[model samples]
Target: MMNTYSFPLSTLGLPNLMIQTSDGKRPVNISEIVFLESARNYTFAYLTDGSRVITSKTIGIFESPFAKHGFIRINKSIIANLSYITESCKNEGYAIRLLNGQWHTCSRRRTSKVKKVIKQLKTL
Candidate 1:
């Protein structure tokens, strides 16, 4: 459904990249790299083509300025790319529609802040 490119790491000495299949066993090749915070010892890398959702735990507290161009910190646990946002609404709470058509909510703790940012984004 989505275009993917894969490169082998055997030659370059970089870690190999693979796509997860529906069966959860077959790892296919895909193109594109995304950085995510690791739940354990270190940060990890992943493919952007449906490989995973970026979560807050995977991101470091000190964020890169470059990430500001496309990503927004929604709360303590989530940071999402504006490009992947399909729609968003806020009233008493905040809800966002992602590119995959999935809806995610901004926790009440972060709702006001989220709305403020969304408002700013609309003007830009």
Candidate 2:
């Protein structure tokens, strides 16, 4: 079973995600998360500082909450932060490179939406 934390917002007034660790629940700033990967029933949050936080919650649970924070479901197993996306690999078929140099491919069904989002991000 997973432990839950009551706090919904961080000190910065941004949403906080409670990450389950060995010690206890740790609140992480939504903006600091660069990407998320699903592993069976668990989800791994990859932060900007090269750290990873594991939570027992399914990745689907984070989709809506993270959308407002600039996260997009790039693929079935990966949700990427738009701010962390460095480049879009058009030659590689809807692949995007994150700040950590990790690449994630967008699923066929999501390709159009991903492209539109990337295009908008590039303009800003």
Candidate 3:
């Protein structure tokens, strides 16, 4: 089972994430994040503004927290924000297009889960 951590600023009524930066931790609104890509032990956070932030933590560490905020692990190395997904491409493969026009293919093993989550999101 994956471990889950409560967002630190929840009590303060802020949906923000204290992401680790080179200098220290910085607060970023979760809604501003579009996706997260893993790079070995590090993870890259792509924001809606087209900016990227690198954190020195494994992607796994973020899986649970992000999930609670509507982010889904579309594949082994990527966790995408559901709100940022603009389209689903079924003709080519199990892929999704983000607001930034970047396409990410879901792994075969994760395609079912991704589809289910997308369906659920559409209902809300």
**Residue-level lDDT for 14 in candidate 1:** 31
TM-score of each: 0.49, 0.85, 0.85
Note the Cα lDDT for every prediction shown. Answer: 0.47, 0.81, 0.83
Error of 3 at 16 (Å): 1.2
Ranked by TM-score, the better of candidates 1 and 2 is 2
> Which pairs clash (backbone N, Cα, C closer than 3 Å) in model 3?
none
What is the descending lDDT order?
3, 2, 1
Q: Please write out the lDDT profile of model 1 over residues 6-123, one tens digit for every residue.
A: 2122223233334233445434222233333345433333445656533233355424542544455565545555555657765556777655555567777767766676666666
Question: Considering lDDT, which of the candidate structures 1 and 2 is the better prediction for this target?
Answer: 2
- Candidate 2 positional error at 96, Å: 0.2
Model 2: per-residue lDDT, tens digit, 1-124? 1111121223366677778886799999888898999998999999989999998889999999888777899889999988777767766577888888887889999999988877766555
Residues 1-124 of candidate 3: C-alpha lDDT, one tens digit per residue? 1111122222244388899899799989988888999999999999889999999999999999888877899899999988778778776568888888898999989999988988766665
lDDT of prediction 2: 0.81
